[model samples]
Target: MDDVARLLKESWTLVEEHRDRLSGHFYARLFLLDPALRQLFPAEMTGQGDRILDAIVTAIQVVDDPESFEEYLRALGRDHRKYHVDAEHYATMGVALLDALRCTAGDGWNLTYDQAWRDAYGAISEKMLAGAAADGNPPFWHAEVLTHERYGQDTAVLTVRALQHPLPWRAGQYVSVEVPRHLPRVWRTYSVANAPNDDNVLEFHVRTPPGAGWVSGALVRRTKAGDLLRVAAPMGSMTVDRASERDILCVAGGVGLAPVKAMVEELTTWNRSRWVHVFYGARRAGDLYGLAGLRELMETHPWLSVTPACSEEPDFDGEHGDVSEVVARYGPWTNHDCYVSGSARMVRSTLRALAEDGVPPPHTRYDTFGDL
Candidate 1:
């Protein structure tokens, strides 16, 4: 590899040992160097620390692959604009990031390593700046929650209307959400659950999972109509490649069904020749919140078939098993394009099943942040 890639690998390994402090140290340095940035982030630095470190780790993974790296960096930059990130903050942030690396690398840090980090950060900064400038897109969209309907104690369907701006997004992309009431500045990404509409209304299906109650609870339980929220730029690679004429197999687990639902909506509008089979699963029957919508799509689109599966509650189910297992039972999907979303474990399981059933890696699509 390249010097930047190799040096990053070395630096990353060392940094991982100090993972708990990496973001904290970096943010500390960032605020100290430029105190103005402190207002841009969340008041509670709880999960924020891990996010910065995760972003860095994600960047290092694809730096050797220029095309993948460029797309990721560009999307990352555009997403940062939601936080009011400016061109100048990049320099301060880069310096703080390098300081974190230097602290983590400690005795191992050298002139060569220093040069590599500078080069890497420089490249990252340049792409982010270019991404932020390439399209005159707004920093973030202001949306009002028109409806927050809860299907169960945990799941809610939110309809949000963007004000005076169009947030154009491809089916299957996701956007970050920030609740000003519950915890300002702390954001979580959620998939758009329906295809675009003239009403400028977007649907989001949210479920409050364990340990995610803070944000999810706010979204599903406390959020009410007329409540204001900030929506970040849409970014994802799992979107439909309309050019692909292959049949589709969509596997979704729990809230993973959100993006899959959007894809299905889009598919219904496309030429009906291509067939699609959707297998959606949840832990319990109550968690399978969108069966009514799926059924409606199936009735309207002759080429579409939906199978709702569940791992629990066997008494009155259509399909009974883990969704990955259910997908494998129906597969030999070598000729079909496969898309999977869900919890990290579920996504990994589904991919493994798809692989075992002869799906090619190239034919399987998911968001880079599929697990997150």
Candidate 2:
């Protein structure tokens, strides 16, 4: 397994830089092999190539760990059900992917590398097939937007209720959402901002900068109450461990507060002794829209405390500098079960700080958004 993982990683470098060409070749080959499969994908195909590459890269990174590898591939399989993928589709995809890799790598590709990927893809497809066969839930859920509240120019907080079927999700998991009316077949992931409940409602906090993210932009700027959305299966591992007695440390930046808020809300139900400290930050005071709700939660849950910070607004009456720096000033968080969610830069900085504080890697979990 180690040798296979090593070969896969080394071979990937030969074509990772030429991802666009590789993806183009892969898709072309796939269509040439079976024209019918092209109908499963979106017509635009703007960010579609990157999504497939990201999945492959992630699979490569976790291949050596059997538990995580199987779990991730299975979840990915369940998520791909939204595209109506089946066993034969996986086999065809593997063939196209291998051909593209070989063509992109050219002379750098080897028989060992080819064999490694073949074995790995076999395992991947098998696990994914098992996951798809085991799932009794629908490929996607139809959800009605119950409310939409804008925050500044680029952010919105919205709630939706799944229609006809229950969408079960853990506190820190995220699900792929597609706005069929705006950008059909284009799905973007958003963390569920609330815990599971009998009401079958879910909340999402979105921050879409100008000209970026088709799905996010539509959700934030164009979506309104009564609109319908397609919600896919949830996938993430940042949830709290109820059995662990350690104190909790949560650091959130920008719209990344969604999952942290959900975890805290879940903890509120049965927590009595554990202390959960949340450090929420944004570039300016105006962007810290979720701080008010966190503050309100603190009023009722004595064990919970939230510290809001603004990196760009010095006049605001709270901590200054990056949220990661604020967390470092409050550490040593080595004894706590730490969870960090934010932009890639913020999560990276906070993870570095936690590592510096001697926190064990196993004790920390993180979710990063925006091109990570």
Candidate 3:
């Protein structure tokens, strides 16, 4: 390894040694220094602190190679952008991190150690700031529930009126949600299902994931019209290229349709002439939401086509298999830009299948809806 990489690895080891102390001290220092940030964090600082520390530790562990590290750091920057974190907050976080390291490393934590990490953090934060600037500062969001419609048992679609001016975002972007007043305010990320337009209203198609947590369960069961919920601004790397003329192939599994729906809507609005093909995968007919609306959209747009794939369809006509199988039957997807959104495993599997079928990496994109 090179000198910088070696130094980063050494510093990362120190961070792990003092993980608990560093996490405790960092949050304590941040909240104590900036009482305003206290509102931004969950009421239960203990768990939140640990999570922050874990992210920091993981960030440092991968810092040896700047190229590989950039992805993680970029994701962190995006998450912070949702919170409207500025340069000052990043500096504060760096200070707290360095201080915690100094306390933990004791005699071993010298100026060299501090300088190495400070430099690393500076580079990372610079890239973050640049990215934010390019994207425009997304406001910390507050959602006003305008309308809620039950799709089926345990599933609902909410039309939220974002209180602040939202950032310019493409379809397939996601935002983090938190209920600050609630104890252990669980942070969860949900896809923005609305097309980017002047409507100034954001829509989310939310379903209770199996073994739902408190926040998600409550949102599905109890959240109602006029209820205000804390939302982070939009953040995600997955999006349709409005500028591209290539055919767009959207593959969605389960609730993965949310982002795909947004993209299709945007494409229609843009009058994109390239053929847009949608492959929707679901386990059963009941699992299929938005099918009728999508069919109507396809009928109205000559350039769009909708294909529904049901894995458990016993007596069905049309595509009755996995999404990959349907795609294969459609034949030669070589010229299309494919977007896949679903569980991580599903996304991975689909991407691999696409690659094996001759889709280049440049033409394939996916988003795994893992924890924020």
Candidate 4:
């Protein structure tokens, strides 16, 4: 392990138990340092507090291997553009973060820990700035909600158009969305559900979890036509492997099918021999709200096949039980390129199932909520 990694890991052990206090201290100290910075964050810090702690832990883990985390940091820096994050903000944040660590780590903190953290944060900030500077893309695009179609109990499909700007993105990539109504300046990740069109329009599939956050609830139950939103550049690596001639297998759970759907559409444009199969699952028949769209795609593209399954809905007409089981029945997919998406837990379980079904680890790709 690198010296910085060892120092970060050691300091993390000392402060991990105090994460709650650490996050609290961070915002308190941040605002104290620069009161004007408060406008960049959400009005309510309830859910945002947990996000801070999660971001720190994730950063530390990623920094454990500096070379491997370069792309992630770049993507993160680019995404922070939507939040109006500048180079100076990175320096201010580094100071507040180190102060929080010093307070939380108590007597275990020393000059060595301080120096190591400074070096690590410096490295991170430099890369993030480079990422933001590489693309001449604007910080955020102004978009108007063209349509919001609420379907089923808690699901909605949204289509929005960027105002006078081009938002270029690849299939299977997700973008962070910020709704001014719910929590101003706060953003949530949502997969773009369609291939880019000439009209500069983007589509999204939003599912409201049972006690969803403010942003999600507003999107599903409140956001309507004409509501304006800010969209960040698309980020996520769950894209189609266009160079490979191997067969493709995409597994998705619930709303996770958004990116998978995008990938399928991209495949249709290529007149190639590679076959693609999609296995999508939800809890009940009502939960399979997007089945019709998938069916429509399959009809248009003979090379693409879709299997919609419901685990708890006994009355459903389609395949019954876990979608993983349905996928396993068709396997040992050793040569297939597999892409999985969903919550952390769902992705974790599906990856294991694919592994057991003879899929090589390198052949499988999935995306996490890595919003930098």
Candidate 5:
């Protein structure tokens, strides 16, 4: 497995630079092998290739760790259920993938790389298939948009109610959403901004900055109450550990507050002794859309505290600096369970600060919004 992992990573460098071409080859070959499979994907292929490549990179990186690898592949498999994929589709994808890799790698490709990927893909498919098979819930749930509220120009807080069936999920997990009215078959993942409830309502915080994010932009600007959406199965591991008694430290940036807020809401329900500190940051005070809610929560819960930070606004009150910097000043967080979520750069910086504070890897959990 280690040798396979090594070969996969080493071979990846040869083709990673030509990722766009590689993805093109992959989809072209995929459709050539099984033209019918093409219907499962969106009509527009924009940004689609990056998603698969990211998954492949994740799988390759974790191949040596059986437990993590299995968990990831399983979650991936279950997530793909939304596409109505089957075992035969995985086999076809494997063939298309290997062909693309070989063609893209050119002279750098070797028999060892080929065999390694074959072994790895087989394991990946098996676990994913097993995960899909084990799940009893529907592949995707039909949801009705109950409310939508915009913040400024690019951000929105929306609530939706799952229709017909309950969509079970943990506080910190995310689900893939397809707004068929705006972008059919184009799905985007969003963290559930609120804890699970019997009412089957889920809140999502979406930020569609200027031109990016088709689904997010639609949800924020074009969507409204009464619109129907398809919500896929939830996947993530950032949920709170009920067994742990450690004080909690949560660092959130921008819309990354979704999961952190959800987890904090969950904590409020049963927490009595543990102290939970949240450091929420944005570029300016105006961008701290969720700060008001967090402050309200803090006032009602004696164990909860929130420190809002503004990175670019010099005159704004409260902590002024990067949120991670603010966190560093407050830490020695070695004894606390830390959860950090935000843009990739923010999460990386905060994680670095936590590490510098001597917090163990197992004591920290994180999610990055860049990939979403």
Candidate 6:
């Protein structure tokens, strides 16, 4: 095997040998070394430590494949951005990671092994920093709840007044919300429903996922006006590429409309004269939100078309079927850049159907809610 391959194999083996200790020590070292990061993490560091170790080990195992490694790392970097992790914090993480490796390797961890791992991590870090820079290192938003409107029985739409100058984010970018819950503060990511230029006020459409943890449940039950929620700078890659100049197809399922709503708003604002079609899916008519606003936009902007699809609400006006089916009927998708947002299952199935219907993968973008 090549030198790089051999080094990767050895690193993998070493990681496996000291998995438990490495996981434990890595976070311990991090927290002890950087009290700032410790503050950001959960008070129950044990569980968070395991998560960090699992993420790192998964990343390291994929390093031999550059393309996949880079993709994985980019996703990690994007996710971390929501946590407001800066380059300095990443440096601290790297140090902790290396120290854990050293402890795990014992006497066998010499200069050569250390150097190889260092080089690998340095490269990854550099790429991560570069990606963040390219994404326009957006500043964190300090927001106060302007109004919290209960939409349906279980959903709330929060209008926040941002304290900082807003960044130009595409639709589908999510903002991390830090709420003072039980303790240590808890963070959750919510998609922005309002368009980008709606600067002073940002809107979030949130639903109470059944059996969710204290953070989400509390937010649903207790969040009220005048409350402050720490928000991260907008971060996401699932954006409409306006440079394409191609027609656009937007698909949204349930609350998935949040991100797509942002995109559609942007499109309507930028090209009030351009034609775009939107397909929204929900189980029932009551489950659908923002249709009236979308219809208003369509009416005001002559170039826009809105199609609502209800799977269970058969009596609903407009389309009646799965979103993918509605999208197929509206083809040919090859002429448009298709944007999808919803649960992973819905996004995957919709994308697959779109591809099968001749929509190229490059022309399709998606944002899946919940855990990665």
Clash count, one per candidate: 0, 0, 0, 0, 0, 0
Worst 10 residues of 5 by lDDT: 208-217
> What C-alpha lDDT do the candidate models reach, one value each?
0.86, 0.93, 0.75, 0.84, 0.93, 0.75
Better of 1 and 3 by TM-score: 1
Q: What does candidate 1's lDDT look like per residue over 1-372, in tens digits? A: 477899888867877888877777898899999998999988888878877777888899989989989999999989988788887899999999889888877897888888888999899999988998886778888899999888877778999998878989989999988898888888888899999888888999887755673677799889999999989899888988889999999988878888899999887776578889999888778788888889988887889999988788878458898988989888789999899888888988888898898888999986433332
Q: How accurate is candidate 2 locally (lDDT)?
A: 0.93
C-alpha TM-score for every candidate: 0.95, 0.98, 0.75, 0.92, 0.98, 0.76
Hey, what RMSD does candidate 5 come out at? 1.2
- Give the C-alpha lDDT of model 6: 0.75
Q: Which 10 residues in a row give candidate 2 its minimum summed lDDT?
A: 363-372
lDDT string for model 4 (1-372, tens) is 388888988888988988788889999999999999999888788767777676667677878666657877788889888878898899999999999999989998999999998998898899889999997888889899999998786789999999878999999998989997666888888899888778998998887777677778888888999999989988877888778889999988888888888888778788469888899988887877778988998898888888989889898898888887888887878999999877677787788889898788879989653310
Writing each residue's lDDT as its tens digit, candidate 3 over 281-367 gives 877887788788899898889999999888898866668987777777785788999999876766777887888789988898787
Tally clashing residue pairs in candidate 4. 0
Tens digit of lDDT per residue, candidate 6, span 1-372? Answer: 135545856766866866778888888798889977876777755445555666667666768777767876775665566566788988999999899888877877778778777888887787777666666544355678888878767677888887765645556788777675343445666788877665567888877767544455556668899887777656666887767878888898877889888887777667844468889888888878778988988888888888999988868987988888888887888878888988777788789889888888878888876531
The alpha-carbon deviation from the true structure for residue 308 of candidate 1, after best TM-score superposition, in angstroms, is 1.8
Q: How close is candidate 5 to the true structure, as a TM-score?
A: 0.98
